[model samples]
Target chain A: MRRDVFQAIADPTRRAIIGLIAIQAMTPNALAEYFDTTRQAVSKHLQILTECEIVRQEQTGREIYYHFNPGKMKEVADFVEPFRQLWEKRFDQLDHVLRKIKTTKK
Target chain B: MRRDVFQAIADPTRRAIIGLIAIQAMTPNALAEYFDTTRQAVSKHLQILTECEIVRQEQTGREIYYHFNPGKMKEVADFVEPFRQLWEKRFDQLDHVLRKIKTTKK
Candidate 1:
C-alpha cells in the first residue's frame, strides 16, 4: 500500500512519535518509554513513518535509531502554511476592527 | 469513531475538498462536481469533516453550504509550526556553512 505523510500522521501516537524524533533520534525501546504502549506498537508506528520517509532508521553500534526527515514533513507544513497565513490575515482584520472601535470610543 | 483534523485530512480527496471550500463555501452538489465520486460519497466525506468541526454547514434557504472553520485548523497549524521552525533553523545553519565554504573558496 502507498503511504503518505497525512496517513502517517493520522494517528495521535504517530504525531507524538514525530514530535519526539524531531527533537532527537531514538530507538523503538527508548520511544516506548514515553507512551503507555509496548515497544512493538511503537515499532509499528515507526514502520508506517518509515514507509512515508517521515522517519529514517540509522544503525550504530548494533542499535537502530529513528531520525526525523524534515524534507518529508515539509509536505505537511507546506499544506498547512497557506491556511495559517489566511487565518492570520483574518485575525489581523479583526484586530484592526477592535482598534478602530477603541479609537471611536475614545 | 472520534475524528480530528488529522483524520479529516488523511485522504487526498478530503484535502482537496478542504482546499476548495477554504476559498469559498460550497454545497455538496457543487463539491461533487469536482470529484469523480457520487454525491453520497461526497456527503460522507463532508460528514467526517463536520464531525471534526474542520468544516461547518450553513443553511441558506434550501441549500446547505460547507464553510471552512479556521479555529479547528489552528490545532493542526500549532502542531506543525514548531517543527517547521526547527527545520528552518537547521536550514539556516546549513546556509551559514555553505556561505563560509563559498567565502573560503573565493
Candidate 2:
C-alpha cells in the first residue's frame, strides 16, 4: 500500500486530531474547540484523514461523530514493519561490532 | 521529532531511492538512471530526504556516494513507536472482543 496514510499523519494538527478521536468520538465542532484553528481547517485535516481511512466519520443523530479507525493505522504499522526489522538488524550488527571492539580493548 | 521523516518518505520515488541505497550506496547519476525522472528531480528529492536526515551523501574520492543513513531511520522508527503501540493495543482489544462474541455464539 502507498504511504498516503503515513503522509496524512505527517501534519501535527492531523496527528492531534487522531489523538483526540482515539480517546473518544466527537463532532467536528467539538474537535475544533480543542484546537486553536477554525473548524474549517480542522474539517480539512479531518477530510484528508478520512480519505486515508485513518479516521471514520459516522452520522450520529444530527452530528457527525469522528472516531479512530484502528484498521487504517494497522496498515501503517504493517508498512513500517520491514523498515523496523531492517533497523533492528543493523543495530544488532552495530552492537556486535561494539562488543568486538570492547573485547579488543580488554 | 516531527513527522517530517514520515512525510519525506511519502513519495514513491523517494522510497525507491531509499530502497536502492538500503542495498548499496550509489552516485546521484547512477541513482537517477534507475528512475524515470531527471537527475535534477532526483536531486531535489534527495535534498528533502537529507533535510529529514533519512539519507546521507558523502564525498568519497571524486564521487559523492549516497548511502543509507541507518541513524536517521532509527529516528523514524522511534517516532512511530507510540503509534505502533497504540495500534497493537487496539488490535488486542478487537481480538478480545471477537473472542468474546465467538464464545457467546458458542
Candidate 3:
C-alpha cells in the first residue's frame, strides 16, 4: 500500500535524516555516525524515507550514498497547496465580508 | 517540547481531518460522524491537530467549531523550502556537470 507523504514525514528521526542528507549525499554509515542510535536504526529510517521516495540512494562501488530527492517532495507541496490556497481565499473573502458588515453597521 | 511540523503531519487520520476541515468548518461531533471511529477517537486526533496549530477551534454557543489554520501550515512549508531549493539547485548543477562531461567525451 502507498503511504501518504505526511505520514512518511511524521518521525523526528526521519526529518533529521532528511536534513543531514539534504546538505550533502552521504554513505549510510556516515549518516549513522551523527546520531546516537545504532546504524540499524538509521538504516530503518532511511528505508522508510526511500520507500516514500523522499530520499534516493545510489550505490557507488561498495558504498550506498543517500541524497535528498526534491521532486518527490514536490508531491507533498502539491498535496497541501490547494488547501493552503483555499484557506487564503476564504480569509480574503472573510475580510471582504467583515468590511461590508462594518460599512453597513456605520 | 516543540514538535517538528513534519512530525505533526505524519498521521493518515490527522491528514484526513485536515482535509475535511479545509473544505468547511464543522463541529467535532459533526466531523466525528463521518468516520467509523468513536467520537472520543476523533476528539483525540483533533486535539493533536490543535496542539500542532494546524487546526483551530472556536466555541459557538454550545458547540465548538474546527477550522483549518493556514498560517500554521506555512511553518511546515517554510521548514521544507530551504531543503527543497537546495536540492533543486544541486540537481541543476549536476545537470550542467553532466552536459560538460558529455561534451568532453565528444
Candidate 4:
C-alpha cells in the first residue's frame, strides 16, 4: 500500500523523528540517542517513514544513513500552499467587507 | 478536549472543508452542496473543525457563516515550514557530495 504524507506525519514521535533526521542523515543507533525511547521504536518509525517515501536510506559500508527526501516533501508543501493562499485571500476579502461595513455605518 | 491541528487535517473531507471556507465563509448547508455526501456528514466535520479552532462560525441573520481561522492554521503552516527548509538544505548537501563522488570516480 502507498502510505500518504498526512498519515505519515500524524504521530508526534514520527514528526520528531522527521525533524531529527531532516537536519542530517543518521543511523538508527545514533538517531535513537535524541529521544528517551528505545532504538527499536525509532527504527519502527523509520520503517513507516521509509514506506511513505518521506525518508530514504543510503548504505555506506555496513552503516545505513537515513536522509531527508526533499522530493517527497514537495507533496506536503503542495498540500499546504493552496490553503495558505486561500486563507490569506479570504482574510483580505473579509477585511475589505469590514471596511465597507464601517464606512457605511459612519 | 483540545483537538490537535494534526488529527483535524488527517481527513480529506476536513481538508476540503478548510479549503472551501478558506476562500470564503460558508454555511453547513451551502458547503454540503459541493460534496455528494450527506449534509449531516459535512456538519459533523464542521463541528470537529470548530473544536480544533480551525473554523469559526459567524451569525448573519439566521444563517451561520463558517470562516477559516487563519490563526489556527498558522500551527499547521508552522509545522511544515521547517521541514521544507531542512530538506532543501540536506538535498543541496547531497548534491555537493554526489558531485564530489563523481569527480573522485573519474
* Tens digit per residue, CA lDDT, model 1, B17-59: 8877876789999999999999999999999999998899999
lDDT per residue for candidate 4 within B44-79, as digits (tens), equals 999999999988999999999998886677666766
Best by lDDT: 1
Which runs in model 3 stand beyond 4 Å of their true positions? A86-90, A93-106, B1-4, B83-90, B93-106
Candidate 1, number of clashes? 0
RMSD per model, one decimal? 10.8, 10.0, 9.5, 9.6
Q: Which ten residues in a row have the lowest lDDT in candidate 3 chain A?
A: A97-106
lDDT of each: 0.80, 0.71, 0.71, 0.75
* Index of the highest-DockQ prediction: 3
Q: Is 2 or 4 the stronger prediction by DockQ?
A: 4
lDDT for model 3: 0.71
What DockQ does each candidate score versus the true complex, computed on alpha carbons? Answer: 0.25, 0.19, 0.28, 0.24
| Pairs in clash, predicted candidate 3 | none
**By TM-score, how accurate is candidate 1?**
0.81
Q: Per-residue alpha-carbon lDDT of model 1 for A1-106, expressed as tens digits?
A: 7499999889989988887777678999999999999999999999999989989999999889999887777778767766665566674454454344334321
Interface C-alpha root-mean-square deviation of candidate 4: 6.9
Tell me how far the alpha carbon of residue B74 in candidate 3 is from the true structure, in angstroms, after superposition. Answer: 0.7
Model 4 Cα displacement at A52 (Å)?
1.8
Structure candidate 4, residue pairs in collision: none
Q: Sort the candidates on TM-score, descending order.
A: 1, 2, 3, 4
